[model samples]
Target: MNTFHLGLIINPLAGLGGTAALKGSDGVAQEALALGAEPRAAERTRIALECLRPVAERVTFLTFPGPMGADLLAQLGFAHQVLGSLENGATCADDTRQAMRLLQEIGCALILFAGGDGTARDICAAAREGQPVLGIPAGVKIHSGVYAISPRAAGELTRRLVEGGLVRLASGEVRDLDEAALRQGKVSARWYGELTVPEEGGFMQHVKQAGMESEELVLVDLADWLRDSWEEGVRYVFGPGSTLHGLAANLSLHTTLLGVDVIENGQVIAHDVTERELFNLVDGYPARLLVTAIGGQGHIIGRGNQQISPRVLRAIGLEHLRVVASKRKLGTLEGRPLLVDSGDPLLDDTFPDAVRVWAGYREELLYPVGWGS
Candidate 1:
């Protein structure tokens, strides 16, 4: 097997400097508490590091000093080769370039960083023809194809690559989006060229649910089943996706097509509920979570709704919850697996040994819950 050196960088404020939207967390420091927004980046880096722990034995991890990447790795009891020179206050963006240059000089096979779209551009600045990199989706607005579906997905993909999982490497595009236009509630997409993205399994594109015309009828039938099978006296916390939104359309109610919804037996109790609100809804009404994997990415939880905290998941229990995906959607997953963020990290730790994800009514597929080994 060929071993690769993966350099880890955390652009502490890359996404924060963008527009005042919630997707950009770096600028959040100026808007909120003086905690410097370190916790967000720190926690994400920690999550990324935690996922990489089991794979530690498979690859060489090259890293920078404190706050850059080293501190988080050390805290997790992970050993890595420190790449560049380390010094004071860990001046944010300055160190990102320095760390990237050092990784290139050291001949690292790939670089994995965590941040938003700006961080992706930063990598694009120094990325070469054959250099491969991956991003742990931590930034507020990660409208880029360079990112792994989720933090754990990033780790799983890295693990698969190290295990000689026949993977293809290709040049993936890096997009340049207009932050101001997006802030003005407009969509303006521009090309920013391509970077070498290691072609591997499980990495997905967020698209308008694919294979639409063919699966339209099945989707329609699935929607009817969901609305009809809804339990009485129990609340339904529907995560974002067209499939979940289908139930709302059938119920003669409006829902957030791209957000979480809390519904009662027949009415829309609340729309665009957050992770916190979802938990409260479940507690107050005794409910189950109904979610579907993102069309391209095999993620059922932890994509857009950070409001569904871990505390709520434990209260509702995954045993009572249901995961729905169209047959076409399941095919794209390619056995990559499903993920749940559940605000609290520990909940994903204790999920069921296996879950029969509902691909459609009378259609189910069995997949494991926990497997870091």
Candidate 2:
């Protein structure tokens, strides 16, 4: 039996800044960990790998030492060969680049990595031209178009390649955000390069449409509608996005542009909160979640706002949730359903098939919703 070689690299420190409310984890992994932020890369990689279990005997994984890859592969009892080594402590971009070089040298059929856009940038910088790679969405700033819609989708896509199924390869743009400017309420995305990726639109995500859309008037109308329709005692858990930022401005509340914020009675009760903080704030209170879909991506959950976690979403009943997006942004989807990948399959399944999107004043469109995987 000819075995397919799969390369795996896990950026253990990726996404630490998300739940810690630090915006992006580019230079603040330690700070995020200090704030009690737990790393989600390994667990997300595990989920992706779980889909490959049935064909395990047909696939051989080439991976780096310890937390980068081997550790989780061992935990899952997957047959994998460990390569290279790390000196100590926290891993850096150089380590990811090094792993990329090693994987490329070994001629693995496909390189699977888990992390955010920064990690993608490192991989892109070190990659040999036309080297096939795929990303598992495990990072905070996932503006890149190279990643799968979700971890399971990544696994499923890889499985197709291993099983000799028909899969088209295409160039995917690697994009990253400027963390400094992002923290200052600015959304700046730059195209780093491109990677050879599996061309499956349903399984892969489009690059995030950075900054606000051109329809400023629509945003104003939506904000005014929300301001007027605000319930008296309900706490609104606002997820990150320029649409919500505009809404916050109308209420004169300074909300985080890339972090979750909670407001009550037209005032911000909590500014830039973590997952735990958000859960605690609305665990037993009248709460509603207000989120906007990523332009061109149609992701209302699980992209940048990991803080509106499964528990938080469950606590704020699905019926109480709200979505806001411009008609132009909705048109970017080209008829695809809005996506939700809260990391819990059961919770994801409970979401309504279609959600009521507030596109303008007194205008509501029932948009279809789909699981990210």
Candidate 3:
């Protein structure tokens, strides 16, 4: 039997800007740090490794030194080889590139990296043709098709690849947005490059689509259902998205397009609220969270709407959480589960095996939800 050699690389600053609402972590590490943004890439990588525990004995891990990769594996008790060195503080793109080159030189069968689209681009630049790479998503904007839908999904795919299962190698797009433009509420995306990814249906994400015309009717139907099902004196916390915005429109209420809002009795109680403000509002009333998944990405939480923090989710509880998405958006996932990364691992596991999503008026779909690392 041949031993499976997997290379690991982690960009420590991958998702530091998410909850801070800075949009992207590319060049705003210092700003995000000043705003008290914590490093999440390593923790997210640990989630993937936890899922890989079943197959750990059959694999050897090659990783970079310190916070980049080796430290997490060591803590997990996985026997791994540290391939390169880095300074004590702050690992840069060059470190990722160097680690990739070294891993390639040592003939790693696959490389499992933790970061966002920017990290994906760095790996793509260093990877040779036919080299299979997988991404554990831990970024603010993950529009790329090269990542698993969630960290557990990443581990599942990694296990399948190492176990000699029927896995297909496919070319995946690496896309990134201009961080500056994103902070300004303007979406400016560009194709960085392509990477060879290990693909298994329902495990990896598809590239996000621009817009869908058919979703309008579905949104109106869902909005109608919400209007009919309205409970008296119950407060509704609306998450940021076009879907929820349309729902607000149906109620003839105003909403922030990309900011969290509070609605009561079909009226806007608060608009463009922050995390603290959301907590304050939900505490005194019967509240429920209303959110939609990122089309094609399949994330219901912890992507763009970080305003609904884990603290808020816990206060609202899982039963009070409601998800709405069009059938078209669900179809883009190809049966992948809806994802949530509230930045709290314990809170993430509190969710049930599946949750019900309102696809249209009187139409419900039971979809599985996973914690995206």
Question: Which is the winner by lDDT between candidate 2 and candidate 3?
Answer: 2
Report the Cα lDDT for candidate 1: 0.65
lDDT of each: 0.65, 0.83, 0.81
What is the Å distance of residue 159 in model 1 from its true position?
0.6
**Per-residue lDDT for 1-373 in model 1, tens only?**
1234578888765545334444455435455334334346667666666666666765667887776778877877766777666566544555676777778776565688888776787777776655667887777677778887777777776665554332335566777567666656777876676776654533222223442434556556666677667779888787887777775676677999888888787788899977677777777557877777776566666777566666777778766667766555665756455565555556665564334455444444444332221
Look at candidate 3 and give me any clashing residue pairs: none
Tens-place lDDT per residue, model 3, 1-373, is 2245688999999999998888889888889999999999999999998977877886779898889888899999987988767777669999988888888777665789999988998998888865668999999889999999998889888876554333455678999998888778888999988887766743222223434536778878888888898888988999989989988887788899899998888788899998899988887678989999998887888998998998889788777787887666767776566788889988877664345566777765445566797
What's the CA error at residue 192 for candidate 1, in Å? 1.9
Residue 208, model 2: lDDT of 36
User: Candidates sorted by lDDT, descending order?
Assistant: 2, 3, 1
**Best model per lDDT:** 2
Per-residue alpha-carbon lDDT of model 2 for 275-302, expressed as tens digits?
A: 9999999999999898999988888989
What ranking emerges by TM-score with the best candidate at the front? 2, 3, 1
* Structural RMSD, model 1: 20.5
TM-scores of the models, in the given order?
Answer: 0.49, 0.54, 0.54
- 1 against 3, candidate with superior TM-score: 3
